[model samples]
Target: MTDCDFLLVGHGIAGATLADVLRARGHRVLVYDPGQANSASNVAAGLMNPVAGKRFALSWRAEELLPAAAAYYRALEQRYSQSFFTETPIFKIFGSPEEQNAVLARSADRPWGDFVASLTTTDPNLPGVHAPFGGAWLQHGGHVAVRELLAALAAEGHRAGWLRRESFDWTQVQFDSEGATYAGQVRSRHVICCEGAAAVRNPYFGWLPLTPNQGEVLDVECADLSPAQVLNRGAYVVPVGGGRFRVGATYRWPPFAPGITAVGREELAARLTVITDLPFAVVGQRAGVRPAVRDRRPLIGPHPTVPNLSFCGGYGSKGVMLAPRLATLLADWLVGEAEIWPEASVQRYNALQPAGVG
Candidate 1:
């Protein structure tokens, strides 16, 4: 059997980032990804959100996560000589007077004061848009074209002789206290499972409370909208280059259904109508299942009993914002230099883990 430092499953943002993090530190990494159609990272717009929801509350630890994530993507962009991440400000239109008031109050406080600006009127230069209740200018965050980024990283990994373009069968994996061996073809010093929404089927981590959710987004050509600005009114419209914009993301939580539907398309169109009245051509629609968790936090770190096996997923809608930072922490933890953040550690559910079967 061939030996390697890590054998990663799933090449979504979680796996791809974790693979790169570990590889950068001098580990021999082999990633398994057949590029599943329903992979969330593939279908995500990869928005880097600093402020979340209607309350205008600071995204969980935005102070630490946002800047570092931008830097990480920038560093990779430089190394690969490819562009994917873009720093585009989101113009959040207020749907009600209450929503406008929340932004006004939050933008006056410390930190929150620094993240957004309450806008009383739409900029005259930005046309094809109208906000009746005013809006908020989110001063931080951007978007990552996830599919391109993953392909670029995978190309580098393949060139370096580390990536595998095949599915990993659980039946062929043997895990012991020491580590894991796959099909007796590669003996891994550590195995990390980054399976996005598919983590519900992970026999090794079934107890982690992984909940899958489906979301759909539409690609439309809007020539009149500002290409540099992302506009949101509950739903978002982000420019994805070539004069085309991506509008989307309707959340279908738990009871997890699969695939795209006409209903989803109609719902997005209605939401987009509320966000903007611009004339546009519908170009495409895509759907994927988000690897959401019941607690709505990430799951990282090694198996409680197995020791060498680990997990890094369940970032859900926040995958782009959280992946890099969490991947760095997991990399350090792998080398015995640090511990996973307690809030994000798989250990959080240790009390619920059934013993002797990790």
Candidate 2:
């Protein structure tokens, strides 16, 4: 009978970040993952965009999450002696006059104004693209190499005796007065489920309103275009490591499947055609289900029915930016040092529950 402090279900960003945090605090954590599931974090471009394009509004909690995310990634890079995070500028091309005007109008609001640069009349760097009216530069926003970071963390965890390559079985879990037990290996006091979109299957949290979305990305090898900055038109063309670039993300709701479809490919090609004239080769196609919620906020806290079973999933499209600070908050709450915020806490959805029933 082995004992551990935690049994994390998913090896995606949410689980990886939480495990890293707990391990740093000298708590032993055992992560169980099969490595076959398509996690949204794995498909994510990991770009941290402070200013949202649709509404021209600052991302919810961007002020707090952005800096913390940067610091956290940088610290991890230093610790691992690797470069996983890079500070690249995002060039948001103007799609229409209304979009440009919206950005200008938002510039007057202190913090938002501080993040967005003065709207430019023309783009000098990448021409022949859609820049009829030009675009604005987001100063601090950039991309994190999520794939590299996760791989490195998984390796480090294995070396430190904190990660296991196996799928979690609910039948092996036992709940008693002390806490939860799994496979006769009782470690830590609790188990935090970080199983991205799969959290819908969790009996304790299955009731939470989840609106999962299927997202797809194309890895295109474009040798003609070599811009150092990320290009954003309707879709983003983010430069991954080496000569390869990532272009994508078509959001589909409802009948969501993990496989890439011809419709998604057509959608991406159409969007890419609007932004670039260079011929590109589609080397890879990938899809994953994003654990989006009805309210679009993250669900974090202890399970209502079983107190020892906690959760920290439902990051939606902003997992890279939101994970660091939220992980800290969850860690604090688990240690009984702080109370979870009502806005982000799972209690918000629990409020809709019938009285006396979790």
Candidate 3:
């Protein structure tokens, strides 16, 4: 039998980063990921947008999250000797004149100014796109090769003898006063479930309102698009490399179903012309489930009743920008050095609906 300090039951951004942080702090960690087909991290476009949504408001804790994410991914890239993060600009097309004025007004402020590189009116003459309504080039935004980063971390964990490429059977979990045992072979002082969109079925944390949001993306090839540019008009067209771009994504809520759909493709295809006039050949299509919560905040902290059991999920599309910082916070809390954010803490839900989780 082997004993460790933590057993993480997922390898998405949250689990992988948390494991790395814990291991860096000299804690024994065992990460389990079966690589589900519906993994959002695997199929996500991994956009690190500091200013998101219709109001163009700064993301929650954007100042801290954005730079922290950039620095963290950079460190991961250097450690793995791979390229995964790109600090590119987001040329966000405005919808109307009112929208443009609002953006410009915010750009004059201190914090918003830091992210607003330049503002465009009636269109910024960028290639391959028809932005008649103009756009703003948002700085400190970038794309993260999420699948690549997850794969890299998995390989490193395998090399370090802390990650398992297999499924964790909850039936085998036996909790004691101190920790829990897996299949009577491995013992961990704590078990944290970072099961992304599949968390709706997580028995311990199922009570939380983890709405599974489905998003589908398309990979297209074009001859004239620049890989250095990212065009954002709600749904974005991100250049991957070598005349290839990723056009996404369709946010389907509730009655969620897995896999790509023809309707989603048609929707993106129709909107593609609005974003750009360049002809493109659809190279590939992918769909994944984002673990979106009811309140749109991440689910973090321990179960209300289960000892040494915790849940970390519900990051939705913001996982790329948010996971590293949240993971660090959870790590600090785990070792008694800090408290979890009240908004993101699972305790909020437990307080309201203690009997909600099955």
Candidate 3, lDDT over the whole model: 0.87
lDDT, candidates in the order shown: 0.84, 0.82, 0.87
Higher-ranked by TM-score: 1 or 3: 3
Better of 2 and 3 by TM-score: 3
Candidate 1 regions exceeding 4 Å error are 121-125, 254-257
Tens-place lDDT per residue, model 2, 1-358, is 6677777889899999998898889887888887754578888889898886667768888888999999999999999899988888887888878888877777768788777766785655574356777888787889998988898998887887778888888767877656777877655578888988887776666788877889999988877675587878889888886767888789999886659998898899888888877777889888988999998899899777676888898999899999999989999888888998788988788755444533
State how far residue 307 of model 3 sits from its true place (Å). Answer: 1.6
Count of clashing residue pairs in every prediction = 0, 5, 1
Clashing residue pairs found in predicted model 3:
123-134
* TM-score, candidate number 2: 0.94
Best by TM-score: 3
C-alpha RMSD values across all candidates: 1.7, 1.9, 1.5
Model 1 scores a TM of 0.95
lDDT string, candidate 3, 96-177, tens digits: 8888888877877878888889887876667778888787889998999999999888888888889888988887898888
Q: lDDT, candidate 3, residue 211?
A: 83
Better of 1 and 2 by lDDT: 1
Question: Which is better, 2 or 3, measured by lDDT?
Answer: 3
1 or 2, which is superior by TM-score? 1
